[model samples]
Target: MVSQPHIVFLTETWLSNKIPSSLIIGALPYTILRFDRSSRGGGVAIIIRDYLSYSTVTLPSSEHEITCIDLFHQSAYIRLCVVYRPPTYSLSKSESLITCLSDIHASSPHPIVIIGDFNSDSLCTHPTPIDRLFLDFQISVDLTHCHMFPTRGNRCIDWIIANDPSLIPTISIVPPFPSCDHSGLSFSLSSPQSPSLPSQIRDFTRVDYSAFFNYLLSVDWFSLFCDCPDIDSIYSAFSSAIHSAIDLFVPYRTPRPPSLSYPPHIRRLIKHRDALFSKVHLPSVRILFDQCSKKLLFEIDKWTRYSTRKKLSRVNDLYRHISSLTKPKLSIPELVSPQNLPVFDSISKSNLLASEFASHFTLDDGCLPSLSSSRVPPSLSLFTFFPHEVYKSLRKLSPTCSTGHDAIPQIIFSKCAYALITKEFQSALNCVFDWTQCNQLSLSASKCSHIRIGSKQASPWYSINSTVLPLENNVRDLGAQVRSDLKNSSSIKMRAQKATSKMFLLLKALPFNCPSILILTKPMFFHYLASPFWNPHYSSDIATLEKVQHTFTRQLFYRCFPSPDYPLSLPSYSDRIKTFGLRALTERSVIDRTSSFGINIELTTSTPRYHSFPVRISRWYSQLPDSIRTAPNIRMFKRRLENHPIIAHLAKLT
Candidate 1:
């Protein structure tokens, strides 16, 4: 290791015409001389160890590859010359190189050492006698006199020629590094030292930080501040302002919120105006805003007139901008029809809606079905009534040992009614009618009733209100009697009781045609009297589960089911019940007429018996809708029912 050696990396030094006259050489721990030769295309470089001082001498024009490095060491001058010879084998190569070396040796005040690439075979083919004689005068150590292969073909070309053997430097051809084709050479001599390693490295030592960090954690962190006004409120205010501004850019329906009128162009104008306002030197915000609006309006007008698709708002953010300008000026007069404004038109709104809804329905040419006058919509037929005999036959069927009620006809009628009124079915009406004719009851009804039927149209239930014939009345009254009998007649009641558990199973056997109505009305059998079962949140102590059935009929007057039109379908019932419960009591007063409407039927005189029965009509007809319960009227009814001890206990059931 050279304790203080100059290390220089010379690049592109061998390329004659291709190489530059000047090159940058990095000489670590040394002083470098970056120079250019006047005659040579690639120049020679010399570096001296930093601890050494050197002086240089100018050489003759022919002397191109000559660099002298002088060092003051051991109180004497030590000079070194690093040289390079051209690659040609011509005599001129030897002449030029030898002349350059001789001139430097003659002029030098101290001994010189030359080390470089010399294309010559010295030991094997001795130097010409003339060159050998000249080199001997200096008595230099010609290291090239020995053979050391530096190339694949084993050529001795690299050499160190020195004036004296004792003053000769130690030289070794370093093993080739991966970077270059030639092996590197390192030469060094001892030198005195100054300060060695840096002080930062010497001073640092290991120390513990656990206790210090623990003390830091123990501080009362909350006490480190003074009270300040809330920052969150300010941030929220800014955020709301931004949201309001953005919301203005989105167009809403015609009856728009007072906000959302800020046109994008107008907003941009306002922002520009505000920026100019802050500058103070610019025009007033009012003037600047007016100018910007005029400019934007002109541009928007041009865009609207020229574009095929009418999207002026988006063309240049014109909607929100124009809206922003006029929003502040909005007043009662502007609300009528503001001029130069970008209001959402009906056409645009419809287009927007069509664009939004188009994804839901697939309508190709082949999708439309053939239309025929003979054909009828299923909705018309679903609700179409069977001849009167059908109901009569249904009425005659007795309750079974399993299913309490025959549900098929009822479910079918409900679905048919729904289809007809709601127009929700897609099948032909005549087909349904033809199918119905196949049934025994329908065939008998057709022979008896002679009701006019057609695929084009049919008389709806609502129209029957006007046909108040005695025969129709008798039929309706009979149907009502049948329903009432199912509820009141002891023999049928006993049969139903036996099949009560099978009622749900029977319901499954019924038609899915009027599933909505089935789902709506099914719960009424025992579900409406849900108070004790549900444990009415109003009061649990008043009614216990065991007493529920006995007390159920008493609460019937207070209880109500949904109207037939709304149907007691599960989803609708659930949603409506929740809505009714949450609404103000007065708002929820609308009566469900189907549950309440009926003539008073005194089925039982015993007060206890009345309490247990599912139906016990009050003496007074239930004339009013459920919604009309004012305090005074409610109190009056409460008193009236209370006076009747039987009703008083029933009211508590619900």
Candidate 2:
């Protein structure tokens, strides 16, 4: 009520005559019109926002609890009625309610909206007389409960009914109010709003690297930090110098407009339809509204087909966009502390969730080896920071990557890679490390995890700073989850499911039986639709992925040719490939994986066979023909393999 809804209709408030209005609607910004039972357990209330001008309408009969109000908004009146019929109420009471509704309809020339918990499930075989009465009144009742889960038992007894169905607004069932079994319903009459613009971001790819490096070189570091006595002072001076260089060289750029949720043409049609609907009472306006609505729907269908065809031409981009749009939203579970006490407030819930995660990750210090007793290798000295090693490390950091707990951007580190190798930077790094070690200011050992990928039987545990960091069977590293067995079955299955979902969505968007367009787009669909599921770096069993691709292809074939006996006339996998110029998943994966690595196959004995790039390359190399294998150099061998008829054909698909 305090949030000031235009009109709120509450049923079964359970307020008796004894409970005063001041107690129920205390300090709320609403004018209430309620029908209360003289005894216990049956009541109805309609709370209108204070800004709205409304008057209570007296019913001819008061056999059942009902609240009627005529609300004035934007120079128009709307007859709002809230009804609550007790289960024990007789058929006569229902008839009386319906008669009151008829009287109100005859008196009010404006649009009418009736909302209530009629305590009748219209879908039930034994329909109540109240339901029949509503049907007789020509009222449209929406029995589709907004809540997916049960509000009370398994039935949706509450309904929002309107004389004109279109006036019944969009309703959302939010979480139940405290101690209430019924979920709260929030609704709005307005049409959906357009999506707001995305935030502006810098285009780092367009940065002038040559100008940036030249600016860095021009900076006289010795002159700027001549008076600095300590490592900290030198670090500050260097940071300022690098930032100045960056500001001079790096220019900001605005990206192209983001994709609209609804196409502009469709939005225009919807606006036109809504405008016509507003003047629906007039005979001319009513006819035009009907025509406009039909036109709007036809345009939407036409646009959907056009957009689907366009997206199918660039299927990879479509899949990526859909994946981003359908990414799972994060929601916090009901927070409960270790003591089993429930937390209600958002701040408390957030803190409890963080604490629970911390507790799960925290390790026992007693289980770890003492740091004092541990031997430190002379070559692994923290005091010395080699400029070349520092430069290499900084260069490896991705400029577009996320920041850490320190809130320092990766671009800052990447831009200053050259400066990091300087003597002053090295000294500063060593000083920071020494200070951290002395004061125990490093990240808590409990907050960090150590993962060892190997056979499950031989999984290893690790310790840091005398605290044993917990070992995990699965750990997320650089966005991909790594498992102890090193098998990519789970990852492959997840990717396949996502791809299948996206394909189905695209199929739904496109019109069926457009054989010419489907044929033209088939190759593009296979090439890019499957790209999301194919990861060159991850080793997935070829047979599993092939099955997924084969299933998708078969479904696509059926869609394009929807005859009942289509499968009987369908060609074999190889025959279809030759006819459609489609490549097998195994060949496509091999070609893509081989091409990604190029000729830089560095074999290391220490690397695990499953994860080793050289091992994979060697396996593929063994399958090559003698002509490709006999090349004098790695570069020539790669060229020959890439140009081979089979590999070249498969590469074209990718």
The candidate scoring highest on lDDT is: 2
RMSD of each: 42.8, 20.5
Question: Residue 650, candidate 1: how far off, in angstroms?
Answer: 99
Tell me the tens digit of each residue's lDDT in model 2 across 383-433.
346755544444454344454443333334343443333433335444444
Error of 2 at 268 (Å): 18
lDDT of 1 by residue, 1-654 (tens): 122444353422533322222212111334444344445455556654444445555666444565665544555665667665556435665665676677777765676666666545453465765345434533553322222445312555565566554564455454232333454555443433433544332111232345434544665434432232477755665565444443433333333222322356645654664465344333576366456546655655454344412323242343233233222221111111122222247776566557668966544534334455656443353344775543443333323212223232332334445444323322333344545544312323322221222222443332121332121211223222232212223322332333333233323222222222233322333432232222221233222322322222212212334334432342332244343332211111111111333345556554433533232224222432234222245455444433333332333333
At residue 514, candidate 2 shows an lDDT of: 63
lDDT of 1: 0.40
Q: Supply candidate 2's per-residue lDDT for 405.
A: 47
Return the TM-score for each candidate structure. 0.26, 0.37
